[model samples]
Target chain A: MMTREKFEEAVLPPVVALLVAMLVGDALILLFGQSPGAVYRMLLEGTWGNAYGLGQVLYKATTLTFTGLAVAIGLRAGLFNIGAESQLAAGGFMAAVVGLAIPAGVPALLLLPVYFLAAALAGGAVGALPGWLKARFGAHEVITTIMLNFVVLALLNYLISSRFKVPDTLHTRELASGRLPRLDAFLPAFHGSAANVVLLLALAAAVLVGWFLFRTRAGFELRATGLQPAAAEYGGVKVGRVWWHAMAISGALAGIGGLNYVLGYKGYYEEGFATGAGFLGIAVALVGRSHPVGIVLAALLFATLSQGGLAVNALVPKQMVDVLQAVVIIAVATSVPEVRRLLRGFRRSNDA
Target chain B: MMALAFLTQTLRIAIPYLFAAAGGVMTERVGIIGLTLEGYMLGGAFGAAVGSLATGNPWIGLAAGALGGLVFALLYGLGAIRFRADQVVVGIAVNLLAIGLTRVLLRFLYDSSSNSPRVPGFNVTSSGSGFGALAQNPLVWMGFLALPLVAWILYRTPLGLRIRAVGEHPAAAISLGVPVTRVRWTAVALSGILAGLGGAYLALDQHQFTDQMTALRGFIALAATIFGRWDPKRVALACLLFAAAETLQIHLQGVGAFPSQFVEMIPYVLTIVALAGVVGRAVPPAALGRAPE
Candidate 1:
């Protein structure tokens, strides 16, 4: 029962932006004297054709979903939390510490919840610091978050290298408990892939976030504060309190991403493991238009490109994926209005 | 001799930040956010590298870097100013683009993902000690002159008046018959050129272009801009202060008492502390991030 106009309004810009991104990507591939069509086919086959590829794609998506949700939540509150990278590190670090600390005999059920809770709290605490700074001192969140990212990065490096490093290794000790079970072990089809039950948790979290944003009182206040702080303040909303809460939730979401990477896949927290996943969250949130459902689709698309980059490594520069991702974000940022106008023109012609 | 070494090293390190922070001041003072300064720096760095590599002339590299930064800045202005896209989003997007483009081009040209071959640079090492050493590098002298030049343009000129007017209140400026968009575009483009020059200094100083050679100096320059309260003179001094932190970190690491990571955190932690109003309040120009409607 969906109308064409509704579909056009809702979907056309991202679709066209993605197509533009692909076109730019193809041009880059051609510059290397490779056939763009063949390269793309290889990418598709490597990311989607096999069970292992799909599993890898989904596994990456699991982390993206958490980071995407983190940024999206911040965006909904009119805050740009560029420090998701730092929050993820904090979460992963906390999870690693707690996982290693638990006595060897702890049950998985109890240990897993404890691990997740510790991560969320640690990340939330890190996230709330920036929020408190902003609310108290009127400091811009963008700069503070960026500064915090470097602080976290340096802190993590110091901790790992000085105290937590296992002998000469660049990572902490492996966990004795709290590791999430792999989905492939039960499914068999996803064999050889690290895709795990954490993906289900990611999906469930997305649903819960959607519910929280659209169907809750705090959500209404938060959105109001974002849209118009003065108006929201006049409406009896505690704007500062909302910033603190929104940032805490946002950081908690990014923190949960740590569970996916550490407990779900790596089984230990390593320096540089989060890598650029935190930054990629910005693109995912932007492309998805800050919607929960849209974020999943966008995350999958980006994850495919990432997995495919590895697939096409022999044929093209691995940096091609970075180009495509950047192009997609730029294209979406620049071309959305034009796409909307073009769609409107087409719709008017049809009406005539 | 030790004090002279510290001073020269601090000046050398501060040059890039001074250029970037000045550029940021220009753009932000004209009512446009200069988050794209990061991208501009990267673009300039890559351009300078390629130009120097191709021509074997470091001066040509400097020109190419400015042009590269100008192009990137213009693109950013087209989106954020002309198209009225969200400024922060466009800035972040442009930064990512610069990273990807620079790396890909680096690979295509040098066949390596990490760094480029050493090119000819201004040999300031033989320029003697103290002020003579600083004068040996043409770029360093230019950076020093740039501070006063920017201050003059920002304060004493008619264009500066118009720019400040637009930034403070674009609608008011429009009512007074000023072309707000054109002024902002010019400010942004000029800012890019300056930032680009800063990037150029990185490659020329190191005599090679490495992946991410700017090393987030653009962001630090932004901190400098804030700490300086968007004043050219203050920002120049702030850049030196930050550079001092870097130099001190290096010295501390050489002493080996503290962990290297703790030293690395100095500038970043200070920026956070400063932004949190520990030292003083830093207010941005009104209407700075808004597009003219």
Candidate 2:
């Protein structure tokens, strides 16, 4: 668990960044002749004022949590898995395909495990490729992962469009046994929302990731490698293996994210269903300080901003929310240790 | 005639890549990661479309596009250089900001989300008359010239020497009185201008700016710069090579030789393979991505 000091340190930068980002959003709103106060009020009303909207926010937050963990693990291992966009898609696609392949007489109770394994393996394989390449050939994972995104997405596009696409739709055929019961099944308030069992699963994953990262020896080595690779190598940690396994697990987290939409909501793999979710994960992980508790909170905050984009669309374009998200990232990035040092120097020079 | 047609198509596709790749080479060579190339290009495209639409002149629009990129570059500089923020994260933010800003502006200014109204641009009288179509576009001519000019400035000028010194060893160069920060600022400005012009070319060529129209061209050009190991002449060659692969994709799609998406994957696959040391190892500048202490 994060000590109180660590928690405060982790929370402060993102909180300041959020404030600064909101100021930017205010300026943008004013420039467009809209009242920022009214827009924000409407945004709050649309998102948290009602149970239905809250349910949708939770649904979005659930996916963000998984992707956030995906990225957080990579960060802990000194890797940047920018390829989560395709990794998520690959997981969903593999699950869909495997789900369809199961014989009709198979027990429905066995389906979830099979689909989860299929998704994890698929996402893991794609994630491991860049890791292996970096380890074996000294290739920069940044460029390799970015390139892999295009390659994997293109390959998936080919499969869906030319081979597996349902007759008239852009998505593949529906899965036979991959559906997870929605929250609306039990809760009367979330009647029309997509919130499902996956939300609880996401919570469980967070606890598991936290425990594994903090309590396990493997997690300590991974964090050590991230902090100082040369020192960790001298200390007997297999740096290469940590990177590989961290990436595979990271990919698995993002792959499980795909289930929220594919199994929980849609029951099929639709092209471009979760277009910006993977990138949003970067924002989540960053604001969360790569910690589970922080990640969950950050995901909820972003989920509010995301769903609130639609809520405030009458006052401004939904894209304004995208602008705010980017601004938040910029502010958060500028609040890193390096920038703080620069700020201190600037102040000292001014005083001198 | 057939070969000429093929070459013209490649040249058309290569114009944007050439501009971005050349700019990326300058920025990367100066030791600042040019991850915002995409952002600059997108900003330029949006600027060109708005400028041309307002003024009814492609020349003014082109100038506006360059200015647009300069504006965004300053934003990036504030975060990445002045504040010494994480370059990679800020780069991603800049790109996202460009996309969001353009979309918002598109809706605000043009009342459309997908595209702006058709704007004034260079006239192409002969669609099928080979290079005649490209000959009239001043930006196209400038695009081809940009590579050699960058190469000359890098290899043949005093400023180039200073840039190399700063990139290779900023601390040593600072001791020698080379202004590291100023040199980086200059390189980033030039990168934004040239990459913006590259984006302006796309909007002007199409006579309209669409949201996020630069797509991944900026990335492809950046990849070219890396593939060429940050050498101007070689980077230009890499741009053309990737452009040829794209051209092949289009042609193969037309002929139905392979699935369209698979064909589109060719260039990206090539970049991955080339970066995998199938070609050779790459050594970045010593001071690359490091904030000056």
Candidate 3:
């Protein structure tokens, strides 16, 4: 089953895309008067080479994994859930609010579940809006979801600014309890980094998601709907219901993504925090080909580049990393199966 | 006087939306997604700033802005049209690249992080702060002209008919011997020119290019295109309506404690509502976002 050809088919496109993206990066670095090799080495030394740097990379990857899964699940149902950014913020706000609302006497066991549910519910609610819109009214999810990002963020901004923000600051009061422990508690080498048990939660979510998408009947329905909605409906799948459920589940995953930053690291939700992660998750999901295992790897690759951008900032602008990301997405988009088939001389008129 | 000021402010704000919406309507009508309107505006803004700074001529800056947007549109066209990549994803990529490339160019060309040096622009100080001042800005007049020009071209021209034909039925158009690819390419280029002028409007009016400027105005314009249901006259009305909302935002500042953030949400919220078919259905072109056969 695991033939060399199959393995190559699975791995070749992203590998090729990454190499090409790096070449583009090299040109940019050189344009800025820095040796690409030296800068890249410095990047590696700063991220994968050092334990602390690796921890930072993992921390960033944890958030990406959640949001990436959110995007991938919706993609499976033929929805472009572009509101992961909005959902993530809503989730963080809920987590922060829930953490603060619970009585201090409550056991950790009870409080943790409450916070998690609150975050998930908040994110799911936000995610469900666009889904419901699409299902009931034939609205396009892309436009609605993009609009929702601005709407939800502004709503949260109004709430935090007017009602909840600590005076003289843009963030709310820090949670006094239920904060997740840092990796330094056990992994002493990860000192000074924000890596934590949330990484375990993310990995667990990935495994669960992988199983749900590949093994379950509902997951099959979602995938089938994505492939051909009319045929899926013919086969007895309620395509609209799948759209709603997929988006809600996708949103719930993105909501928990916020816990990695809010509860695990910052213990509070700050305005504009995790701003780009939602967009970056789109890149991650696409690059990973919407696979769980692949998303983890893609997340790590991006995290390295992101953390390394800071490392190489003295030599080249950190924005170079953003450029490389765009190039990578472009390369990946150009090579996806549909385009590949077109390039392979498939004729539109040929039914076979 | 206050009403006149409000009208002038609304008109000034409407200029960019008008230009960018025209661009959005153009590309989408020809079947390419108009997601890159934001990116084009940004490209034009930076290009206009650099041109004006180097040459001290606003007209030259305007041309540079158009060229910059054209370059981005071509890049997007290469990805979406030539490679037949997912149109939405390719559009997002170009937006990302535009932001990154602009930032890099900002630092490389000017060595500043937040803004470029102030440039010469069309806003003439001698004309005072009323309609006369607004009139002196040539771009504003062009902005006012945008909807009518597009409407006439779309309804009355052979090329527009071809564009509509390709969008609605590319296969039939191919059978009819129309060059579908060339028509789309031309349409996208035209979109770039229109949107590039919109971005130039922002830079020329502000007299500087700030970091990551254009700040979601392009999305609002895209929303206008949707809110108008892709009709030129309706889209112009949508643009004016959103521009008025923005104008009201400034006037409502600290009045009755209305949060400016809520006002900012008006356009996006309305667009989503329209898309939800609370209003009539907002349909796209039949061939929109389809991969080439």
Put down candidate 1 lDDT per residue, B210-269, tens digits, no spaces.
888888889888878877888888888888988887888777876887787776676677
TM-scores of the candidates are 0.96, 0.96, 0.97
Off by over 4 Å in 1: A1-7, A337-352, B125-133
TM-score-best of 2 and 3:
3
lDDT of 3 by residue, A1-352 (tens): 5676445555776877888898898889889988989999999999999999999999999999999999999998998988999999999999998787765555655577878898899999999989999999988898899999999999999999998899989898888778888899898999999898899989999999999998999999999999999999999999999999999999999999989988889988898886988888898899888889989999998898899988888898888888888889888887776444553454454545
- Native A-B contacts reproduced, model 1: 0.67
| Error in Å for residue A167 of model 3 | 1.4
Clashes of each: 0, 0, 0
Best by TM-score: 3
DockQ per model, Cα:
0.67, 0.77, 0.75
Q: Give per-residue CA lDDT, model 3, range B65-134, as digits (tens).
A: 9988898999899989988888888898999998999998888899887899998997575444577888
What CAPRI grade goes to candidate 2?
medium
lDDT of 2 at A196: 89
Minimal lDDT window, size 10, model 1 chain A: A1-10
Worst lDDT 10-window in candidate 3 chain A: A338-347
lDDT string, candidate 1, A1-352, tens digits: 5587766666876887789988998889888889999999999999998999999999999999999999999999999898898899899999998888786766777887898899999889889989989999888888788888888889998988888889878888878877888888898999989789989989998999889988999989989989999999999999999998999999999998999888988888899888788778888898887889989998998899899999998898888898888878877877666667677898799899
- Model 3 docking grade: medium
Q: List the candidate 2 regions with Cα displacement exceeding 4 Å.
A: A1-8, A103-108, A338-352
How much is the lDDT of residue B139 in candidate 1? Answer: 92
- Sorted by DockQ, highest first, which candidate order results? 2, 3, 1
